[model samples]
Target: MNLSQNLIHEIKSLIAKAKEGAIRSVDHHRTVMYWHIGERIFNEEQQGKNRADYGNYLIKYLSEQLQPEYGSAFSYRQLELMRQFYRTFPIANSLRSQLSWTHYRLLLRIDNEDKREYYIAETVKNNWSVRQMERQINSQLFERLLLSNDKESILAVARNEVIPTNPNEIIKDPLVLEFLGLKRESAYYEKDFEQAIITNLQDFLLELGNGFSFVARQKRIHLDGDEFFIDLIFYNRLLQCFVLFEIKTHKLTHEDLGQLQMYVNYYDRVEKVAHEKPTIGVLLCADKNDAVVKYSLPENNNSILASQYQLYLPTEEQLLKEIRREIEILNKNDE
Candidate 1:
């Protein structure tokens, strides 16, 4: 706390700040530069559109011409990526400074416009690093959300343009727990799984999606003469409600739904304030029967839901197939 020590600490802090600022500046500049290169190459390719060999040799020739002076960053593969980046985000001004060239490189892999845009908006809003963005996309976070929602609402939430009001908006079905390092084939207790989630709380929150804050684990609640414990408690700011979760290591049943419903009622009556929304309860289990779920809850009930949990990441092909199937269903419903 001496004056000299204080000065040293202040100078060190300033130096760290400057270094971070410089790194960010460099990343932003690199991104903008790549965008310009992509723009130039795209224009050149358009001009050569009439030629048969135009598109085939454009990147290779460009790489040969530019790599010598510009270095490895202009390799044929990198050039193609740049072209893809430009194609994904045509307007240079639409690119975000918060994202780097690495981020866009991963995003360019996504061919679906809505999914790509959703990832971009979520990345910026969540301030996800390139690695985080990659993990989310690989885990099919958008598709998982789509499992519970239709296209319009899911896309709106992805864009961060609309705040979610209902519990369905924020809750994802079949929560991916690969980050927990749990084995799908092995038997595990709910307590062990909950502990794993607590250990990787950051990833859990990310998986939970926007506006969730962890409250407690095995949160204690007491009634007239008995004690009750909620497995996990989270508050969603967007819904302005408490999201109480009951962890089940087995198949979801009417009993499981009833327990969660009781928890939801307790939270709504005891924990929630007058102005706040009703508490939402989620029964996260190994499996769920849709018909059972429909019969377990009231006909118009939206407060309680049951979702399955997958210990491993679903393959891209699997997710795409599921997405296509769901879209077809939605289209049929529309008609």
Candidate 2:
């Protein structure tokens, strides 16, 4: 190409890159600005201790004056949200530009600090969108982790750079698969459920939680001149490992665990790179007994897990009862 032509191409590329960067910078500035505005509003609101009603009135008056000048961005609800946003994240420097205003709004709704921080770290680390963050929070991701890990370990995972060192750190014992939209009593084959997971793969991966990316479905493996097919394969970027899944529509059995172990061994020996961590295996089934899972696997079983999958969203009462039961178990064990 001629020098002038090359120069024009380079100019166009630079312009496009600059425009992208400018847009990102503007968004970052806007996020920080809103955080500061929230802080100011919260401080002012506290100053009127006796007139508890003053905050609402002030927001209304501000909206009236700013709406025409600032457009919908300065609406009463948005300003109120900004105030709450500041209350949620008191430190301005903690505001992450990767998370949009919508994400902060969702985070503010979570009352527990530990849970909120867990979601924040996971969202930023996994690059989750606002919708994904909301879904995970609603699904009780923190509670699930707490159930699977000790208090100190769970808190450490939530608060620090220490990535999960074992499969149990990231795996949920009973995975809620309501996102698949399968009817509760639907007479579906295991293959059907597997196919649905593959079809709605993106949603499934989100439901699977952080670090998971689809690798293959019904992946073929050859062993000792014989062939076997693995149901689903995923690679978790956070764990730096491959995940092999076997789907079952019935109660879990020792054979199922044995089969998964073999697959895990095969992947670790033949498929896993030298630098990568050990391969993890999961048996996703309809129902599982903790005792069965415990006795079936080896004493130091960290690479293999058995998790139950639900077809429908549990009732609120049932969910609450389950949470209570989990808490009770933890309390009893503590004694």
Candidate 3:
């Protein structure tokens, strides 16, 4: 390239970096300002309970006063959201710079502290845009994670207070495939679904949860004279192992589980390092039988898991029901 061309490119890159920095600075300060407003309002509300009670009147008055000077951003409803933002995240020091006012506003709606904390940690870890954050919340990522594991363990992992010790710790049941933009009415093949997942790989990785990176698609495996192909391969740095996924367009069967087990064993014996943990295999199917899943695997099996896949986002109630059902079973077993 010519010197002039190179110079122009360098200047453009520098300008882009500066613009990004300026945006971050504006967002961080805006978040802090909202927090301060929330803090002051909360203190006033506390004093009101002991002395005078302004209640809704105070918020309305502040909105009126602030809007005249600060513009429409400080409207009555927005002010209320800021107050909630402060109430939900009491400690100022805990706020992340990467997140903006919009991020906290969405987070404040969650009544569960552990769920809120998990979202915060994942938001930062994933560097998710505000829109991505909203989608994840609406999809009930926290609640879905609860379905595959104990509530306490899921909460602990989400908060970054504890590392995942096994595959189930990072795995989620009924992996949501809404991002793939596929309709259920049309007849589909496993490769079609696999291709869709690859096309929307970024969203797929997010749906797969944290610490996942794509390794291969239609990954080949050679055992003696026979050659086999796995649909998808992902490596989880947190789990320190490769995660193999096989796509199935129909209900899972015993033979399907056996195939995945073989893949897991192949990866463990051949691909995995001695220090790394066992490779985790997921048989993602349209449907699965719990009884078949239980009987197919050994008594102490953690490496292979059967998870159903849905083309649409799951309702929060659906997740809650499953969690409650699992908890009830555990309680019964305890008794």
Candidate 4:
């Protein structure tokens, strides 16, 4: 590039950054203003507790007085939301400046304090946009991560209280792929699925969890004149390991696990340096037999994992059922 072109690029970058900063400043102030409104409303309601339906009356009255002046932003519904926002995050200092009011609005939908805290930590840590956080919440990302992980440990990792040492800590089972836009009824080959992932690589990385970076596609390995191709590979900085993914368009079998395990071994032995952790292999299949997966790997196996993939998001009922089933399986194992 010529000097003029380089100068122009630098100027554009600077302007873009300045605009982004200005937008963030506006959002932060908006969030703070809403919090103060909520706090005032809550205090006023408390003082009028003897009146019947006082809280509702107060909010409704406030909405009436403020709406004409402030517009729909202070409507009854919005005022109620602001009231709940203050109740949810009682301490103003605890509010995250990186998150806008929309982010907190989405978080208010979650009733569980632990779950809400986990999402807050993740949103701030990952710097997720409002839409990205919404998708994660709708996909029940927290509940999905709990499938093979303990709640406390998962929260700890999200809060950065502890670093993830194992794949189960960060990698979710039954990965959601609704963002890929693949129809559930349509048949797709492994190559097609891999191609779709590549096309929506950014969303895929988000679903893959933290610290993931793309490495290769159809990465070839030759062993004793035999050529083999791994579907996709990623590096996770948090785990400090290479993650190998083998896409299976059908139900996972013992052979598939064996193949992924071999790729993981190859990566650990050939690709990884001494300071890095062991390579983790995952079988991304359309369906999976958990019993088969259990018997395929050793009891202490931590590196090799299998995750079923779905083209569509699961309903809340379906997610609850899956979680219950996983819990039952864990209980049976203990027994």
Candidate 5:
């Protein structure tokens, strides 16, 4: 018996499809296996009256016995992580095969149930990678949201698919730049910092918060045979607007605000679609003068914001002072 050329081709295609399916099935099974392992470890730890000490001893003994045979996967750290995996997601049925164990590891660190749930929803909704998820968690996305809105509103936005409409809803005031690894006392130029941000663009985007998708760096614009370039361009799906950012190393100036306004105008008129909301322009600077910002921008300004970026994390005392100042200002306004 001889096979026809068409039959051979069809058989090859079927074999390829079968192989692909098998690979997918294997991955699915692996994920399930890890989840079950985590679940079993969790239950055993709970059964022990002294769960914490028991867990520690279990991991230590398990690693001593299993590491030689099973390799690094069965080590103390890995077993501890597996135990945490079960604790984080106690309900076995709730485990999602689409998400990797790494994703759950990050979620386990978040102690707040509502916050963890919000991240879970946002991660799945945005299709964020594990790195992105970790970045968001580290940046304290939940705390930032809490500061901006009431509990009801925050939970509503998280549970439902409702995207934030206002800039304040998502934007962090003192944007952290520790990821850039710049020294506080280092006399680096604005261009140097901006370039570093460009180099670490993916991390920068994650730091920028949710809904931001990078569009361009130093994006060129041409008008009347003259050319201008915007420092950074991004689209925020949650805000339904284009976000334009300008970097400044020195204290923010009126000129900087004016320049950002111009960029915002250009984006609104030339770049933004009719269905989209107004374009937002952010001036990322080392320091900002509140009076200068108030005087430069319009009273009802919502499209433009001046945010100070810190190379290093500020001390708790400094943060407390800032909070106190904000409270004072709010009190005065109420008066």
Candidate 6:
């Protein structure tokens, strides 16, 4: 580029960076301001601790006094949120500057301390936007991860204390695909579903978990004049392996697992380097039977997995049921 063009580009980049930095600075201060407000309110409430309703009365009174002057930002509800925020995260230094007030507001909804910590670590680690974090929470990402993995290991991975070695550690089962805008009632061909994933690739990646980069769609291979195509391929930097996906619009069967296994074997033999791990084969089916999945693969098999996919986000009832079922399976295994 010419000197003038280069100068203009440099100026634009500088201004953009400055604007982003300023926005971050403002957000950080606002978050700190709310924490202080919460702390002060808590201190005042402690003085009147003898009265059962003093905390409520204090917040209501403060809201009335501040609302008119500060507008609805100081509403009684918002103040209560601030108070709860402080109670939840008492250590001021523990608050992450990378998170904004909105992020904290969403987090404040979670009552489970362990769940809260996991989300906090994941949000910061992934640099999730407020909306992305909300979607993840709504989809019950933490609960889903807990289905196959233990809580301690999950938290350890989220906190970066140890790298994820197993595919199940990072891959979520029953992948929620509400963002694809595909109707649950509508019948979609495998090609159409694949196309939708590509169209909404960004959201797909977030839902897929961390360290995944899209490689190819309908990745073709040949074995002695017989050709095959894999639906989707992704390389996970964290796992240091290729993740091959086969989309099954219908219920999963042993045949589906066998097909994906063949593809995984091909990648491992031909594409995987010496330093890389074995390729993981995932059958992204619309439905699955856990028993069939279990018996289809060898008892020691670790590379092939069957994960069901839902076109819509699961409701709270569904999430609770799934969690209960997963817990039951774990309990049965222990016996």
Alpha carbon lDDT of each predicted model: 0.88, 0.83, 0.88, 0.92, 0.80, 0.93
Which structure is stronger by TM-score: 3 or 5?
3
Clashing pairs in 6: none
lDDT of 2 at 162: 73
What's the TM for model 2?
0.83
Q: Candidate 5 residues 36-103, lDDT tens each? A: 77777767767885655986776688789989998998888888877777667777788765566677
Off by over 4 Å in 4: 1-3
Comparing candidate 3 with candidate 6, which one achieves the higher lDDT? 6
Best by lDDT: 6
Q: Give the Å shift of residue 315 in candidate 3.
A: 1.4
Candidate 3 lDDT over 211-273, as tens digits, reads 899999998989998999999999998899999999999999999999999999999999999
The order by descending lDDT is: 6, 4, 3, 1, 2, 5
What RMSD value applies to candidate 6?
Answer: 1.6
Backbone clash count for every predicted candidate, in the order shown: 0, 0, 0, 0, 0, 0
How well is each residue in 22-47 modelled by candidate 1, as lDDT tens digits? 99899999999888888888899999
After superposing candidate 5 on the true structure, give the runs of residues whose Cα lies further than 4 Å from its correct spot: 1-72, 75-81, 150-160, 215-229, 269-273, 313-335
lDDT, candidate 4, 1-335, per-residue tens: 45798889999999999999999999999998999999999999889889979999888898899899989999999999988999999999998989999999999999999999999999999999999999999999988888788899989999899998988888888899999988989987889889999999999999998999999999999999999999999999999999999999998999999989899989998999999999999999888887899999999998998888978877888888988998898899799
lDDT of 2: 0.83
Better of 1 and 6 by lDDT: 6
> Residues 1-335, candidate 6, lDDT per residue (tens digit)?
45798889999999999998899899999888899999999999999999999999999999999999999989999999999989999999999988999999999999899999998999999999999999999998998888778899999998999999998898889899999999989988999999999999999999999899999999889999999999999999999999999999999999999999999999999999999999999999999999999999999999998889998778878877888998888889999
